[model samples]
Target: MDRIVVQAAAFDAGAEIASLREHDASVGAVAAFVGQVRDLNGAQGVDVLELEHYPGMTEASLAAIVADAHARWSLRGVTVIHRVGPLKPCDPIVLVAVASAHRGEAFQACEFVMDFLKTEAPFWKKETADGVSRWVEARERDDIAKQRWQGAGADEATQDKATHDKATHDKATEGTRARPRRA
Candidate 1:
């Protein structure tokens, strides 16, 4: 089973991981990544981080990323949680957890989900520093990270399938490039 949540409330990472493995004795390894709001972005000192997204579209994009992960790996379960609204430094922003029969599959799937989420999800972020707020621009490093996953999973057939699926997802969510302001 896959669990996906997009909410404004903070989440418990340990609880989420436990939930992913519940009643699943076959899961021998679990990999999880928790992203937190940073206190600084380069030279600026960040006071708060605000995130916004088109509700339904954001969930759909995350689901597509998880689906792609399943297509490439034999994952027993997956959980993804993303928080929106204003958050202070150290607040958990996102969580990606993967459970599998082997460590390799779990680790790879967790990393793949995060890489895709960073680029594919239609989430916009703004940071406040020294009482000034500015919209955060997408980083080139994230694009490079996503590109590394291309043709790099499972067998050739699976890689082709994932590629096709990703293309379809990208086409479906392309219009969301123009992000909306925080409501």
Candidate 2:
């Protein structure tokens, strides 16, 4: 079954979790997160939140995030659902769930999918408050959270190359200081 869903209709989180579990009995642990629309935005009271996304681009981005999680962890199943259109406070915004043989992989992969989705996915949010609407910006903390996965060694080959280049440069320039010389 496809693991990514982008829709305007609301989804039942409990049902979604059950579906993931039923699909794979070998999954011993399931970790999930459901994000909701908040009533408050900073100091202002939020009346509604409108979520918009680029259709194909959004789905592709989400699929890539899920694939990245699978590549980094031993995952049995993954579910990512993101809602679009107008939503009120307490309405579910997103869901990220992962199933694995152990709790650690499920927990980490669930978090990884969400962190990347928040920063990497092509979703735009607009908040309406006091008859005014404004687009929200990505949080710095979200970026920092996503960065933690970079050290997972997905780019170890690239890192190795950088290290090799530095070593080569150091060896080539060992004890060499450039100075003006007389012709």
Candidate 3:
């Protein structure tokens, strides 16, 4: 809760790491994650990327992600930075570093925050190929990734919605199968 950073420019991982370590002696480990812009998207190879984020909502959204991670685990310091605007291949897209008394908690918190950010964060990435750019939507892989990191016990409504959605989807598939196919 003491540290919050959300920016539209590329972040320096080494400098950030050093800053995190300063004035924090109780931390036994600092785990970090940095996401980059890859050059491939399906059939085409991406040459550039234009990322956009809601100004007001973006900060609030990332802060909420940090807060959620702190609430879920015992964390000492948390820092998250995501870049916007145009980016090239190998450019750092996001950074997440978590400090805790132990390594396990720090690692888990870092990964968890990333997974949640990929799925829940408001930033959007649009891959550009030969100057064509399109907004990337949430993917099934992202959802699955987030699902894997969900705490051992989740809230009642979330559990209920997951179960309810599955049941509804299953019934819909069954109904389609039971009906005659169109010629």
Candidate 4:
């Protein structure tokens, strides 16, 4: 069973898990992830967030992601729920759950589904903070996370390692720089 829901109403993650467990007797493990709205985003104080998505397309995209996860793992069931519309801090945003006959498959499939959802899903988010509103930009880290599953070429991995090396070196030397001290 693959259950995908995109709505504005809040869903109970606990109930969703229980439902999946009851769906199959052969299920031995279930893994899940819940994303929630936060009060702060980096240096900004977020007042509220509005999520928008193309109705039919959004559901179809989610289904595709679930299908990919199923193909990669031996999952018995998958459940995904994503909320849209006005949401305040601490509100639930999304949920991804997977059930399998083994713990490893369930865990990997759950993570894979979320990684793809964050980068591939067609959901736009507008954040209002400090009398300002802006669309959230896609994070590079999310892209990198998704790339791990893409079988990225060794050249790309080498470049990523070099970038990480430079960042680490810079950080280690940052504190050694001379700076004006407060009187």
Model 4 clashing residue pairs (backbone): none
lDDT of 2 by residue, 1-183 (tens): 447999999999999889888857788778999999988756566588999999999999999988878777777889999999999989999999888776656776798888899998999999898779999987999998877667546554564465456546645765332221111
lDDT of 4 by residue, 43-145 (tens): 5665889999989988999999898887766788999999999998889999999988766567767987899899988999998998788898999999988
lDDT of 3 by residue, 136-167 (tens): 77789988888865535565356446545654
lDDT for model 1, please: 0.84
TM-score-superior candidate, 1 or 3: 1
Tell me the spans in candidate 2 whose CA falls farther than 4 Å from its real position. Answer: 41-46, 152-183
Which numbered prediction scores highest in lDDT against the true structure?
A: 1
Ranking by TM-score: 1, 4, 2, 3
Candidate 1 has its poorest 10 consecutive residues by lDDT at 174-183
Q: Could you tally the backbone clashes for each prediction?
A: 0, 0, 0, 0
Q: Find the 10 residues in a row with the least total lDDT in model 2.
A: 174-183
lDDT of 4: 0.82
The TM-score of candidate 3 is: 0.76
Backbone clashes in candidate 2 total 0
How does model 1 score by TM-score? 0.80
Better of 3 and 4 by lDDT: 4
